[model samples]
Target chain A: MDTVCSINNLARCLVEGGFSPDLANLLTLLGGVVLVATIPLVTVIFLIWIERKVAARVQDRLGPNRVGPVGLLQTVADALKMLTKEDITPTGADKFIYNLAPVIAFATVILMWAVVPFTPLHIGADVGIGVLYFMAVASIGTVKIMVAGWSSNNKYALLGAFRTIAQLLSYEVPLVLSLLIPVMLAGTMSLQGITEAQGGMWYLFIAPVAAFLFYVANLAETGRAPFDLLEAESEIIAGYNIEYSGFKWGMFMASEFLHAFTAALFFAIIFMGGWWGPFVQEVPLLGALYLVGKTAIVYVFGLVLRATVPRVRIDQLMALNWKFLVPLAIANVLVIAFLIQVLKALGLMPVPGADIIAHLPMTVVMLLGNLVIIAVAMQVLRNQGREEKMAQEARMAARQQRVVKEVRTPAGAPVGD
Target chain B: MLEFNASTVAFVVMTLFILGGALGVVTTRNLIHATLYLILSLFGVAGYFVLLSAPFLAAVQVLVYIGAIAILIVFAVMLTRSMTRMSEILNGQWLLSAIVGAGLFLLLVIGVILPTWGNGGLLDATVSAPSQVVIDTVDLGKALVDRNGFVLPFEVASLLLTAAMIGAIVIARDDTE
Candidate 1:
């Protein structure tokens, strides 16, 4: 009974008033991309300010109050200073990598924004393998770090480059493993799908240890304390960045902080249940805001920790990775895998131990296993302290006997007989 | 008159890059500079993969070529620092050899660029087909495992890489005994 509507009518429905559907999609995509890229830069500046204040307050200082009305514009002033400064390259340096290294390091982080989904409508590239794509891009920055260090041809730079490699290798496994826990629960890699999976229950409740591991591993990955051996300021004198000056040095500092923020953002996305709060779906676009807010909270937490803690030694860092975190990660992965398998074996479809209680043992095993490990490690520490005390007393007794004999006999000190 | 589109633009750009890189590699005195130019050239080709609507391949190009191969080249240059510090020009009758090489290179460039001059019928035929097709990574992995497009080659390549890796490790061993 209805006549056929015109093609323009259908097109108008799709266009929603502005441009043709195809062109409109492209425009919206470009706009979303601009917003995504701009968000990190803006967040980095604001975070630096927050960090400055948080750091000052933690150490009982007044903080940055010189720039604008309680130092609100301090980062802006810093940015302007960096922008106006001279870019220097050493004479013997490889000019190409020397110039390109900072840009590549910065751009690697920015390009990763393409894979991060902001909202349902506002996504960068909705590729099939977005999560892996992000990991790949993030890892490329390590290459840039190495190149910058080696190309500088300074011994400090070479040492820093080697430390950078070791750090990346150590932390990458645990970080990726902690991330896999959430992905296992969510059952998908798509950011949208992962968020949707968190609607009923966030993975944080089921796996708090994974969240802790993620934070620690991310700090290490970004070369921040207590894992900043590559940038061990006292020992190596600014590490890989010793040869860099002015804007180039500024770029490394900026990249370091920005990468930390980006990892914090990812940690918030996966573990903290991005942008979802109690009854937040009532507001249409509040999810994106909530996500940003949660991520910023995590970023602030990282900055606070960085300011509060002193950097750990390189040996301690390597020991923590190889001895502790790696074992924990392996256990977590096996637990997750076994739980999924047991759940599938039983009639229970999604929830592993919903009805039968068969998978309860596995879940209990994971949590209790980690707890037991922590207890045993503490006991081992106490025992080692006791042993060291005894050893110290024995050494002191031997030294005293030698001194007494020498005092009595004057020259030969043969008082043992 | 040459009609230009995205594909044409990308092809011209990549061709320029490949030729320029080969020239630089051959002519540059500094080994490190040659490696840098090689990376620049690879990146230009990767950009063409993007223009061809194969962003995945473009990404792989940069990751494998610049990230891996170019890095290896630069590392070798650093490791052999003593050997790379010679004069820019080679001693003993280098200019004569260079001139002859340049003449031959010019002939090849002219032969390709001005195809109307003597490329026969190759210039007239429009290349309607894409030069390369992008297979998705998951699909590529499946194909490599499932014996359709890539299984044999994949196994062969993996074996080759394993052999090379082992050889290098063995050769670099400390030989304490």
Candidate 2:
């Protein structure tokens, strides 16, 4: 009876009720796919509304107050407007690819949900390589952006796509490397397996540096503020989707909102003991609630950061990813791997026990190691910042001296001026 | 007669994707369209991996080929001004290349595929394959890192990738001085 909530169990029931086996299986699979797809799509409307309200509050203004109570139905109204809006196809755009990009962009993010574990038993597929599946599907998103940019036949769109590729590809290194820590700790790539392993202790406590790296890289992955040079409106004129209009453009925006929220949910699932709370084991519905609640908290935190931080320069963005996060992520993985091996050799690893509290000693050791890593990373960043600042000052002084000399000279300009 | 097994249907769909996408890739005049078709073809290959029950390999195929390699190709396509609009996609050597490509195709079908799947061969009807053994992700992870497994090869691969990355950066860097 407790297993009735599972898709497999429902399939069995359908078979017993005299449906053909093939039909039953197909129906069950389709049902699961529909459920997984609907989750992100349905939530995206609310996500946009919440984001606007949050941004408005951050900027000291009343957001959408006309649609419904507290402007809850604003997204609904916006959707209607989007549907009725005239779809524009730019004059030199590749007809097929220009139309395909939005669908692919939206579909790829939804594909990621196929592996996300909403509860202990309510996952879509529970594929063995769930983490890699997420990364792979997310990578297809880069292709979608490229197609959008190229098909638009606009220079700004192409530039935006170039930035998207560089940023997404560069950040993927740290994202995948940091992801390795959780996979190593759990000894499984399955998202469900990772979450279940966290039954004892959250990976966030054990690998805080890895978690931070994952968060930063994924923030860039979503092209949010401080890492959002891809769609920096002042610079690239809304990036790859500049020429899109109507529902096609809406699809791109919805995918972005969905991707941001999905990153938060993934962070919760990987590092924050997703769907793990009191009585969740007995009541699976409660697990779903806990997962959503934790995801919302993380999502709100991301929103606040987006509202507060200014966008980074393109060069700075690339340097921050390639030079800083990549090395730090690699070093963090190596140290954590070594620490795990050492702990196992010393017979200090916590024995598998039913009580979640039994894993305290192991958690503490990993937490202390993570603290050391974070401290070292901070020291490195501080030194790098100081050096950069000093160099900038020196350059400015030299330029000022050159200006003074040029002004003092009778000639208006020097040879190299 | 139509056979309606799940795997059979999946195989047909994936085959259509692979062939259609391959056709699209070669026939398209636009470089960007060709790249998009290339992605479709790579995706079809990934789908084939999934059908073969190699989910990890499928993910890697998508991640590397479509995600990284295909995108890099598109990036290169967009950078060059004259390459994007190549009206003459084929050159004077088209006939010779076509002949060679057809010969290679025939060689692959005759020498590699046919003998392996012929009657009483490795993939014949009499040869009942062994029962499926579900290999967990943990085993895959261990095999990559274990001393007797693929640790050395994996490390070497990583080293090679790092070297290639460094080489690429050095080649791409513009030193005006």
Candidate 3:
């Protein structure tokens, strides 16, 4: 389902609707943004409701059931609670950043919402550099988290902020590199352009390994389990958001939900053919509806992952990324490039033959090669963990030997010792 | 000169943002304030870029400048010892610089407006001529991956990134090592 909605599909849909493709594209972009913001906001509210209901089911208890037929109004009631809660400011905190953090976090993710070209026509600003736009803006969320953490002036908050920053910085690299494959395959940075190129076949079919890596990297980015070591409540005590309360916290929560949606949206754009519903592609209204429905379903996949998975350990997490993802990403880039060249030469791929690369089949072969890289990376990281453990044991032994030497005469010197 | 439209109004405001930010950068005594203002200024510049239909450039400006460089400057400032000073933002060099800045601003404004007085005809004729080189993103992208695609300069950009990475490692690592 996560296939590219080619430009032909987009144009066909637009023309059928009696609109110019370019003009439809502009309108689509504007609508896509509004959809991006509104859909996520609505999704977040819905998710919050679903989360409580799920928690109730897990605990074997009935959840909020009084207001508006089986407690559907429960989430609304929660919002009202937040609205009435008194705003608080710590005596010794940076007022500027403290206030700005939530706003920035809430806002930066929306910029990301715009770059994704939905149904090819109802897109955001389909600039030539859409992917770059996504990459550039996504990281700004770090500053927001950092500011939120720093302004809190609490130790736990500080460490949480640091961890969040570190997590984002590390995962962002692999995420970018993995996504680069689709770009390399499509040979364009624009979201719409890439989708259009893939009209022949979804990059996922050819670049399965890249797609897998992208999903994992993105899951980590969205702070889902197996990667969400930053905000482990048992470890960091609410991470960088410990100090936030009331509406400020609501904004942060809203941003997180939005992030989750956008992450899913990007993944859907890459993997699921965005707006490629059955008769929806050629039909006008049905296509738009299908696109939104598909996107939301993609979003739900992440939410389910969050509900199901458990967070991984921090050191283990960092090691998995540094020793595994980075190498795989670098290798992936090289293999794709070489494969593209070979495919061009062999007159197989439709790529300009004069470049004289190999064929499309060769490109597919190179992409398949990633599974081997993933297996190797997994093995390498497992070995790396063993080495780190051995090193740690050696240090502990040396410290124990020092204590033994220093304590030789202490037996008779002091009972307390 | 030419009167403004909605976009032109936006452009003027954006220009002010960059100018004010630039002014803040040079004039402000508090480096942190300067950094904040710099973020503001770059943000304005980005708005200007968007207005000019170069969304990519604007996005890059925000990403590289506001996200990376400005944050780095703030981080560096925090590491320095003089961060605690709470005083008036301006100091000794500000007064002199302000006078010079004002004069330069006046001169530029005059230079721009002066062209409208009959002499603007020369500028209009020059502007009306058809541009030989088409400037667009696709053209730029073609220039990028074009085998002969300005590869030399692109390589230089990569080289700069490498140097910066090395510099970051040196500056950020604990010196005790």
Candidate 4:
């Protein structure tokens, strides 16, 4: 007689209605699956409209308003249009793999929701290794890109896939490294466990550097602004999905948009004390509201950044990941690990399940540690920038000197022009 | 005593994926097709790890094998112009490879299977039921770093990997620079 509409309660109701226990359980399980799967798919339609509206606002233009109220039904109209569009398979394409790529791409994102804790009592599956489950499912996306690129029988598609893979693979290093911070703090990889561990204090306050690293890496992972080289329309002509059309192409777009919002949701859950507002325990549904509110804030921040920032060059993207984010992330993890040990030895470590006030000392110390690391990293980056600028100036001076020498000689051209 | 359960059906499906993908890998003429088939086979192995109730191992399998290694293999194949399309599936060293593969398979059968041939049961003696044991990931992490556990070998393996990475960088360095 539980009031909550949870799977267990539903199963119990079915059992009381004369169904066998196993059959009731099976039906409830199926219903839960449908519920979990459809939530993302349904929400993604609205997410698209929101993304367009936000982007429009950022660029000082009105977004879709022709369809329903504030263009709310625009995504639905687009979906219908996509449905009626011609589905074309290019000549010389690997038809089977080509067709399967979009399905895998879209399915991989949805699979991640299987472990997401929407509320305290409403997780799809409380997998033991939920964080790793996310990482594993995301990794499958690389395979989909490869399959799509290779099977498309288009050079642009292949090249796009190659660049996208490089970006995705490189960012995954920092992404996984930053993910370790929360896992270490929580002492568990399960998303629910992490959320529960954040009850006392959000990890964002304890380890803002890790949160930043995770956010940046995820931005690159999702191919958002400054890292959207995967589909640099001016360069590779739509990249990996260039050969796709109709609903197949639409699926890729949906997954991309959905993946961005999913990253935000994970950020909220892991770092921002997901569903942990006041009275969340008393009203479980309030937890869902709090989670969504936090997620929307993060998601809108991402959209604004996307609209504002220009895309980075491939070389710059690689250099940033390798030289900047990866080292910073590694150092952040090591520093946090060391600080935790120091706090433990000093007997200043907050006990598990302590209140927020009890966590203040540890939070302050960890926050100071993060600020120090950030300071040091910023100083190092400034020095590197100065050195590179000096070298560029010196090279320019030498080039000018050579030009002058060539002008005086008039017979000999520049040696290495 | 085996019941017709969900896991049994899943196992059958996973076996089909593994065997079918492996067969496709060796039989396909297209190198990219072969790589895709190899990914399918690796995914099947990950499925088996899940069935074994080692979700951590399964995630690692997908993350490392399919995500990193398979992508590397595909990258290498794409880089080589002539490797994408193979004129023939078999090479002149097929006989040698076949002999080596068969010998290794036989060795596995002897080394692994022969010891437990007539035991209480093959699977029962090897793999405990999922409900029988629960190994938390925290314990696994502790075991990797514990002084009484595998700390030494773990550090050595990490050092070896670092050295190998440095070696790769050196070999791939541009001489023109």
For candidate 1 chain A, the 10 contiguous residues with the lowest summed lDDT are A347-356
Model 1: per-residue lDDT, tens digit, B1-177? Answer: 567654677688888997798778777887766876787688787778777666667767776677567766666766675655656564567788779888998998888766644436456435434323325554555677675677788899989999999998888787688
Q: Candidate 4, which segments miss by more than 4 Å at Cα?
A: A1-7, A404-417, B120-134, B172-177
Off by over 4 Å in 1: A1-29, A151-153, A279-282, A349-417, B1-170
Candidate 3 C-alpha lDDT tens digits along B1-177: 557555777888898998998888776666766777788798898898888777778877877887777767756765676663545663568778879989998998788755554644436644555433436665766776567667688788999999999998898898894
**lDDT measured at residue A140 in model 3 versus the true structure, 0 to 100:** 70
TM-score of chain B alone in model 4: 0.88
Which should have the higher TM-score, number 3 or number 4?
A: 4
- DockQ (Cα-based) per candidate? 0.19, 0.89, 0.51, 0.85
Residue A410 shift from truth in candidate 4, angstroms? 5.4
Among the numbered candidates, top lDDT falls to 4
Candidate 2 lDDT, A135-223, residue by residue in tens = 99999899888889888989999889888888999999999999999998888899998999888888888899999999999999999
Tens-place lDDT digits, model 1, residues A145-169 = 7778867978888788777767876
What is the lDDT for B114 in model 2? 71
Task: Give, for candidate 1 chain B, the lowest lDDT window spanning 10 residues.
Answer: B125-134
Each candidate's interface RMSD (Å, one decimal) is 2.8, 0.5, 1.7, 0.5
For each candidate, the alpha-carbon lDDT, in order, equals: 0.73, 0.88, 0.73, 0.92
> Which of 1 and 4 is ahead in lDDT?
4
If both were scored by DockQ, which would come out higher, candidate 1 or candidate 2?
2
Per-candidate chain B TM: 0.65, 0.83, 0.69, 0.88
Recovery fraction of native interface contacts for candidate 3: 0.48
Off by over 4 Å in 3: A1-36, A53-71, A153-155, A288-298, A308-317, A350-363, A385-417, B23-33, B81-85, B88-134, B145-149, B174-177
